[model samples]
Target chain A: MIQDIVTVFIKEFKEILQMRGTKRSGWINILVVIGVMGVYMPLMSGREWVTNLLNPISFAWLPFFLVIGVVADSFAGERERHTLETLLASRLPDASILLGKIAAGVVYSLGIGITSLLIGGVVANLGSLEEGFVYYPLDFLGILWALSLLLALLMASLGTLVSLRASSVRQASQTLSLSMLVFWVGIFLVTRFLPEEARVLLSGFFTPERLPMFVAMVVLGLVVADAVLISVAMLRFKRSRLILD
Target chain B: MNDVIVTQSLTRDFKTVRAVDHLTFQVPYGTVFGFLGPNGAGKTTTIRLLLGLLEPTGGTAHVLGFNSQSEGHRIREQTGALLEHPGLYERLSALDNLDFYGRVYHLPAIQRRSRIQELLEHLGLWERRHEPLAGWSRGMKQKVAIARALLHRPKLIFLDEPTAGLDPVAAVELRNDLAQLAEAEKVTVFLTTHNLSEAERLCGLVAIIRAGKLVAFGSPETLRSRRKNERVEIYGQGLEQSLLPWLDTHFGVRQAGLVNGHLELEWPGDRELSSLVRALVERGVGVEEVRRNKASLEEVFLDLVVDGDKEPYTA
Candidate 1:
């Protein structure tokens, strides 16, 4: 059993790393992320990027949106290329399949996310202005890092679950693409519409309340949810239904 | 005795529809077991049940003497599968695909390379080893699927419609390889196919299924020799169904029918064909086609599946 699970783990990890267009797109996503963070340092970190340096000339911006747009395809893209079926049928048990898929998502999403943070870190240290650029605070970057893992984990698990139940890759892909809509909607409900108390409750899902509690809950939730989803999938997966069609 | 695969009234249902209805069959070691059935006859479902891909609604199945439910991973290691579309990773090269699955089965990294090479050569996929399966032709992809199934050198194979998409040439070649594998390696093949010709040509024992029930199970010759009609078709001109009527009256040409542009009859072997033809001709009926009524495997297959199959009410 241990061998089987490890085999599933390593194999799925390779798939996450080597999935179609993943390496190339992953490279581009990494670069774009670096570029966005390189450009966003002045504005977001209000330290040496003081009010005096504010000018259209300083606006080497407008490209950060592109990073999110490009990285959006990573999870849904596997479904499009017809690799999901093979993934589902592997000797790896159902939960392992789900875990590996999520792990791949994290690698792509977090690799890009952290690379962006690092590039932003470099820009903060080497900016033209005299003020410090890590002005968002160490705690802020940590929150972003922790939240990025949570977001990637949620998306990956959701993508795989949808992938299994869908009739085709296109259908599975829709779940991933439209999920951003849910993300934006949740953001709006919490920030713009929800009462202050309600926002605090929902903020717990996105950004952890305390550092330790936040890290523990998101990591714990992802692990526990992954286990539950896999068990459910094993009970639900019917090879005849998937293969015959 | 140690049975490779055994099922005791195994049943699986899709909602109210019984996909494998109280199925019972044993696949002994070292035999090419062909699963014969028409479209939607639950052949694939039965294979899934035995492989532990789907839980049985009732009854039980054992593979390699281990309970299917709890010991699925153990069964999977010893058993291989070749399903439709094969579900290969199109992004990976043919060699990588097989190697990946070999690793899944836990072949050591050192032994994995040789095993994959041996499988690729055996399946005639050596040239395309480096090519991604996505770019290969249908036949090529199928060969890779076969290679992956054999990568771990499994004890038993559950092959669902193994030759469904192959051209006649490839199909025949693969069928020959499967036969040799069965004969030489002493490996058991659990094959599911609707192609009667393929089954008749290759299988050690053929089991015909219909609507989740086992209608017929035995060696081809035994079923052919032991069915109700026992009919044979003799090809020739000057043969008339009316002329055969005399034979029906005199020599027991039970329920004579003309098919394949020839005279057919459920003939009894008591009277020799020479005398029967002479007697018919002497009676003023023409006897140009005077061949012995040897039943073809195809006729027997159709009889078991379509004609002689019991009524739904009875089923």
Candidate 2:
């Protein structure tokens, strides 16, 4: 089963790279993504990017969007291109196929996320020669890595569930985009349009003395959501059901 | 034990429609078994069931001695399928497409490379292996798909309409290649195609289904011979269209028509040819030539599918 999952992972990774038709075009896409997240964003933020924990946290969700962009096509694209049935007909077990896809999305997004951060580090140092070489605080770096992985997995699992039922890639993408939009908008509304006293009360709940507990609670919530979505995806990824679809 | 596939009254229903109804047959080892049917006659549905991709609503199917419903992965591990579509990745090169499947089947790196090369070379696709499948012609992509199906050297393969949309020349070419590979690999093939000519040329045994029921099952020769009709082509002068009705009535002719200015007649095999000729001569029809024509598989298929004959035969 491990071998099967690895095989599928390699195949999926190769597909992600070749998704743009030509190797050159695929490379161009990679460069564009890396240039924006790794270069342009870091250049704009300057030296504060590495020293400032809030600055990196603001961009930590980059991997989440990255995963969402590709995960919607995990199953829907295969069906749209007439490859899903054949893939499902293979010898690989259900768990292997599902895990392979999730792993592909997670790894791709996290790989890009980490690479961008590393490049940002170097850029930050170069731009601020007087500050000598600098890096993200070790503890903060750990938190950022964990946050990126959880977010990537969250989106990958949720996108896969949506893709399995979607008849086309366009439909899956639309559904995923709508869900993300609603989530972000809900957050925006709560933060921007809330009554002032209610907002003060909410902010007060996260006093500096309780900050650690609040962070731990949010992490636990993310972990629970990731586990539930992944479990649902595995249960739904049956050959009989997918073949009929 | 001699059969690689055995289904006992295998059945499937889609809502109000019964896609496969009481399908029962056996495909022996190392033979090309043809599943012939028209559109919506359950050809694809049956293939899906055999591959263990779908569950049967009734009865059972044992492919390679593994139950299709409970042991599907085991069956899939031993067999390969090229379903209704070619199922190749259009964005990837032909080599990449085969390589991916090779990995899925767990061929070692060296063996995968060699096998991919061997199949592509045999199909005359080795020279253009680097081009993405999207840029290749429909026939070429189909050839690559066939190559992928055969890559792992399985004991059996299921091919559903492998040459569905190709032009005549390409279709014939694919058919020839398929025959050669099946023979060389010695793999049992369960092929589903509506092309009776293809079935006649490749399959040693075939089953015809219509409206989710088995209409007939036999060798092409046996099916053709089962029809009680003796067809004759008569080239003569003065064989007018008016004589068609008389010939149909007097000689027990089931069908008689003037085709391309010649008289063609079909009647029961029990009818005598000499008497018919004598009557034609007496009627002042100059009989220059007379020839008997054997019924083709296409004719037998047409009779069974169109006539709705539900009897099943095995030879």
Candidate 3:
């Protein structure tokens, strides 16, 4: 089973790289993202980037979007190209294919996210020469890494669920984007409409003394969401149902 | 001979419609078995069922000695299929396409490389192996798909309409290649095609289905011989249409007609050819040549389908 998943993972990664017609083009796109997120943004922010917790929080959203872009095409692209049926007819088990796709999306997004943060550190140090060899604090860096990975997994799981029902890659991407938008809007509305006492309680939880607990809660919530989404996606990835679709 | 596939009263239903109704047959190992059917006659459905991609609503199918419903993975592990579509990754190179399937089937590195080379060269696509299939022609893409299916060297293979939309030259080229490859590999081929000529030329056995029901199953010759009428044509200069009425009245003659200055008669059973010739000669008709013609598979297929249409579904 592990070997089968690895086989599918290798194929999916190759496909993601070749999606833009050539491997070179795909690398160029990744480089562009790194340049903007790692070099440009950190260079502009300079000394404040290492000192501010909000800066890392802003960067955590990068993997969410990156994962959405890749995961949207996981199953839907295969169906569009008429390759899904062939893949499903193979000896691969259902769990292996699903897990392999999820792994590919998570790895791609996480790799980009980590690389960007490391390059950001280099750029911040180089741009702020007076503040020689500056870096993100160890604890903050840990939180950033963990949160970004969780967010990437969360988006990938949601995207896979949407891709399962979508007939085309375009439709999957559009549906994922809309659902993400709705999710953020719902969160915003809930926070804004919360009672005064509830708002006070939320603020109290995010205070400096309780900030670690707040972060833990958020990560825990994302993990649960990821698990539920992944389970639903796996259940829907039936060979008999997919062939008819 | 060992049988690679056996289905007993295999049935599948899609909601209100029965896609396959009690389809019972056996495909002997190492033979090209053609499942001939018209459009919407459940050819694709049966292929899916045999591959265990879809389960039968009733009855059972055993492929390569594994129960399709219970041991689908084991069956798929030992069999390959080229479905209704080419199912090739157009963005990937032809070599990559075959290599992917090779890895999926767990071919060793050395064997995978050699097998890809052998199949690609055999299909005459070795030179363009590195080029992406997006730029290749439909025939070329199809060849790559076939190579992918054969990459695993499975004991059985299912091909659904392998040459459905190809030009005459491409179709004939594919048919020839398929015949040669099947023989060389000595693999059982379960091919579904509506092309009767292809079936007659390539298949050792065939089953014709209409409306999700098997109408006829036999060798092409056996099916063609199902019609008991033996047709004989007498090409003569003085063959007149007035003799058609007299010829029709004969007890042995089921039908008679004049075609291209030849008197064509359908004799029901074994009859004396000399007697018919003598009668024609006596009727002031010149007996130039006599030829017996057997019914083509196409005629047999059409007759069976028409007959099937007249009968209502029992269940």
Which candidate leads the pack in DockQ?
2
Pick the lDDT winner. 2
Q: How well does candidate 3 score on lDDT at residue A144?
A: 89
List TM-score (chain A only) for every prediction. Answer: 0.60, 0.95, 0.95
Misplaced by over 4 Å in model 3 are B239-269, B273-276, B309-315
- Ranking according to DockQ, highest score first: 2, 3, 1
CAPRI tier for the interface of model 3: medium
Q: Give the better candidate number (1 or 2) by lDDT.
A: 2
lDDT of 3 by residue, B1-315 (tens): 388999999999999999999998888888899998889999999999988999999989999899999899998899888898899887788888888889899999899999999999999999999887888877777788888888999999989999989888999999998998899998899999989999999999999888788888888888777675677888877988788777767654647888877778877646677887888788788888998889888877776776664432221
Tell me each candidate's TM-score.
0.79, 0.97, 0.94
Q: What is the per-residue lDDT of model 1 for residues A162-241, given as tens digits with 9 covering 90 to 100?
A: 66566655665565567757877897876787788876776665653475776677668866775675566556555545
lDDT of candidate 3 at residue B265, scale 0 to 100: 81
Instruction: Classify candidate 2 by CAPRI docking class.
Output: high
Residues A1-245, model 3: lDDT tens digits: 99889888888888888889988898999999999998899899887777776886777888889999889899999999999998988888999899999999989888988899988887877766875787788888899888888889898888988888899999999999898889999999998899999989878767889878778889899889888988998888889988888
DockQ-based CAPRI category assigned to the predicted complex of candidate 1:
acceptable
Worst 10 contiguous positions by lDDT, candidate 2 chain A: A51-60
True contacts kept of 2: 0.84
lDDT of 2 by residue, B1-315 (tens): 999999999999999999999998888999899899889999999999988999999999999999999999999999988998989888888998898899899999999999999999999999999888887888888889889889999999999999899999999999999999999999999999978899999999889888888878877788888877868999989978899878867876758899998988886787678998899999999999998988888887787787774344444
DockQ of each candidate's interface versus the true one? Answer: 0.32, 0.82, 0.74
Q: Ranking by lDDT, best first?
A: 2, 3, 1
